[model samples]
Target chain A: MDSVRALTLIVTMAFLVLAMPAEVALGHGVELSVAPHESIEVNAAYEAGEPMAGAQVAVFAPGEPAEPWLRGSVDEEGRFFFVPDSDRPGTWEVQVRQAGHGGIVRIEVEPAGVVEVTGGGLTPLQKALMAACVLWGSIGTALYFKRRAV
Target chain B: MIGIRTTRMVVLLVTLLAGILTFAGCAAEGAPEPETPAPAAETSDTGLLVFAADGEEHAREGTVSKEGWNITFEHAYVTLADIAAYQTDPPYDVDADGWDLAYDHMVSLPGEFTIDLADPASDPAILGEVADAPAGFYNAFSWHMVRAASGPAEGNSIVFIGTAEKDGETVDFTLRFDQELAYQGGEYIGDVRKGILDAGGEAEAEMTFHFDHFFGRADKDADDPLNTDALGFDPLAALATDGVVDVSLGDLKESLSAEDYARLEDILVHFGHIGENHCIAEPLE
Candidate 1:
């Protein structure tokens, strides 16, 4: 009876060893998608090409409360929609966590007909001033040396 | 004569052009109206410092004997500070007891200089030129003697190294002075001194340190002596020739005689100043 019990235990251990890899592979497959609209729509999925339904998500914006600007779970199709406050502009941070893994992404809010001045390019006034200084220096140097030689 | 006149004409033209350009530059920058210019007058300026070993002009590299030992100075560098103000005549007197020169309103040159006292052909090292300096007769002036920051004697300000021979015995001696010459109000005084400086004209101060003046006298008690007696033999001079004596004063303190040690201390403190008749201010021409 003791030998039979030991054989049964060995069989059960082999079965568990063979099953662990498949479980890990299934858990690791994650994908995210967002749809563009007046309100942002977020979508998450796994590598098996299946939607990750009910995955938790949080959103934050500049000057928003620390306790997540918004929090919810993905819908049946692994998607969520967020309508940012009308006053909110600039960058929005979104965090998604499910099971044992998590990730974050940023969204930018730029209005139409608005432009940013990076200040990396030179202005017309600055270019003119530089040219004038170079010309003045060249003339002064040539005349001074000519006078000295004579 | 024609060349000289042409050069003068060119100089005047350049000056006029420079004046116009200066005004134009200020106007372009939207500067306010220019202030009234000062009246034409003479100004006292520090032009240069002339070095001589003894009374012989430009004799920087030579030997002088004290008692029986030969002495030579290889390098001498110093810094000159601004002159103290005197509201009344007979401006200030030298205080022999201690440093009583008021340090207030003292101005210093930008960088310390090592004048080439060993080269007779070399022009005196530049001290500084002050264009806006006051023009007048200065009663007295003060300066500082400092150690070199780098080179052979890296930290030493005064280096006098040479060979001394006596009684058919020759020995090497070195006096690497690291002590700073602090400015005292009345130390190293020159007599009947009046330096006239003119405005826009170059002038320089000449300070000649007579190496011969240092050796013949020794006083055992004073830190600095106003004068040294020729009759008294300075022990430092004797020790340089004698193998039994050491040149490092700090380590060989017990080996030196009381009088020799005192004289060495005095020389260390007061030997570098521009002594009487040795310092002067004159026009650059």
Candidate 2:
């Protein structure tokens, strides 16, 4: 009777072990790690200093200015963050709009993760004036030399 | 012999001076050639760019003014000229650049277009289109509101013939503006993006006008800047005579209160827009 009872107990234990999930029986575990990356952050606000909270945001890449590279909305603090594709390097345009008021900003991204906020460099009139100055300088130099030679 | 020698020397000096001037002229002309950069890319790929003007639902569906007047338009005529679209490498920022738009490429629609904003058929009247426009994103737009040469809106840059009603009183108004105004704007700010033309594809660039900027909106808070800055219908209604108000800028200058007149002029300057985006407006001089 003792021998028969021991055999029954062993069989029950074997059934329980067989029914257990593979992962649970194996005692699987997870691991985590962290790394550093580059990103861009922008803040939008009204002229009166009020935050444009929940504003629509659109990011245009240099290669495809016609299509939005990324679309999102600003946080309650009117802050937005994005990591541009480093492969595409050139002018990146970000537009933020809330209600009927909004504006666009430009960021120059280098191939090496360098980001720069650029401003309007020169107007056409300014460029023309600069060209005129160079032309005049060349002419004046030539005339001065000619007069001296004469 | 001395006189002969002097003449020879004078002639030699003159010849030398002429030669030097010619050389200087040539140098001046050639110096700027290298400064002008060639276009970044050129392709045979082309598309159609349709230039459109929108008055928005405020004109088509009618709107209630901040002053409680429900206004409906019969005819809203705007005569437009020199409508142009541009593609700027860095993209144009109206706030930063104002009227100074530096463009890499530009497409223009020739001739003057007098469009009726209240036309039930077309909410945004099609001003014109440019065929074979280089496929690109046109990020900047500029146009002039000039007096129509001969049309329903002749002798005026803009004509608004409409009806305004408030509290049992109704007023039919015809407000004409002859001020030649120029508007320079950046990208369109609306639900969907605009001005993106692909190779062999069609695209549109819009010239949007917000009448709510002039009349104010009842839907928005009265304290809202748009409403506060607006020259509401109340002021114009006060200038009505026998249930009608037909006035021009000149007429309003004489009839409306000085403060109200100044506000109206300021409102006119703020009238032009690109979707919800405001533009830099200047007299077309």
Candidate 3:
């Protein structure tokens, strides 16, 4: 009877071990392509070692709109691309989610480079001073001429 | 005569006004405006980022095997391929076209450093330093990994030997991650931000590499999990005192099924640079 009990115990333990689930490593990653004033491209993937298609994507800008600035999904190759509005120039937070897994990437857009037009002209201050000089000269001449005549 | 004198005074005043206007215009056009101030020169190092290998200090050392299995390494090493700096702020031009901008701020070790992932106190190697990093902060860093060849520690980039025991039976095997795949032509890790590396002052950071995640289960696609069950014997178990299962890095193609090779390749490509905090800087903490 004891031998039978031991055998039953061993069989039960083996069945339980076999029933245990396999250890699948949860792997998810993201890649980004960003440039000044250009569309930001992102690629996301899961552990099957393939691109994550149809993943939801959301973008957050610097200001209001507690809601996301842009929303979309990844294409067949698991890629998403979008251009930020011209007005929004700063750090943009991008979040991608799918199948209970997600990742975020922060992209920074620079303010446009400005080209100054010096044109080699007088500044506003210089122009104002020149006008004042002309007025003073005209008034002094009138007073001198009137005084001399009297 | 008085009218004539008045006329003469009027003409003189008009002439004087015109002369003054002309002189002012000339001065405005000729004199250059004061130029904007250049950023201050970078002096002194406040932040330092160092690379290390250990179980505790350098690589992930110890008997941290999965349930019902044990793994050990006879020799494990990874040759660093390239480490470059990226601008943390706008214009985010990676490596600044060349090192001259952010890459060459402070001189770095010219060649690669071969490190053992088993040792805990393997002295950390220096990558690069910031001189007078630009006015804005350097918020991000990126690196690439390459298989080592033509180095003192020749042969495979990674080598492993171990054994696993389960259900009252033990098996031995060997594994090697020698082949380096061309992901976008090279194994490139993306930009990672730790913290700010200011222009001046000594800010030190250290990075350690962890290895167990390479063998973790890949995400599931079907009803049951995949790549989680091990072979009858342990492929990573070290060689026995006499002779045991010896599986070299190049033997995977013939010894394992195509699905297994593909899975291994996936682990190779996505070797967890950001995930599992393998290539992380200490300043982040």
By DockQ, the best candidate is 2
Candidate 2 versus the native: TM-score?
A: 0.72
**Candidate 3 global Cα RMSD:** 23.9
Docking class of 3: incorrect
TM-score of each: 0.40, 0.72, 0.43
lDDT (Cα, tens digit) per residue for candidate 1, span B1-285:
999999999999999999999988989999977668987545344322222222222125544344455444444333333323211122233321123443322223445555545445433444454444343333234555565566655565555555555566665656555555643332122221223334444333344354444443122222212223221223554555445333444643665676656655554443433323212221111
Quote the chain B TM-score of every prediction.
0.56, 0.83, 0.54
Report clashes for each candidate as comma-separated counts.
Answer: 10, 0, 27
lDDT of 3 by residue, B97-154 (tens): 2222333233222456566655444544344454444322332334444556765345
lDDT pick, better of 2 and 3? 2
Q: Give the per-residue lDDT digits (tens) of candidate 2, residues B1-285.
A: 999999999999999999999889989888555456777665457899999998888888888999889999999999999999999967787755767899989999999999999888656799778888988888899999999999899999999999998999999999999999989888886767889888778999898887887788898788766677778999889889899999998998998889878877777776777876667888886
Q: Is candidate 1 or candidate 2 better by TM-score?
A: 2
Per-residue lDDT tens digits for candidate 1, residues A10-92, read 00000011212222333558543333224455555442334546757777674552347888887887676676664767656
As for DockQ, the candidate ahead, 2 or 3, is 2
Model 2, residue A70: what's the lDDT?
A: 94
Name the TM-score of candidate 1.
0.40
Pairs of residues at least 3 apart in sequence or in different chains that clash in candidate 1: B42-B198, B42-B199, B43-B197, B43-B198, B43-B199, B47-B204, B48-B204, B101-B185, B147-B157, B148-B157
Candidate 2 Cα errors over 4 Å, as ranges: A1-39, A85-88, A111-114, A119-150, B1-43
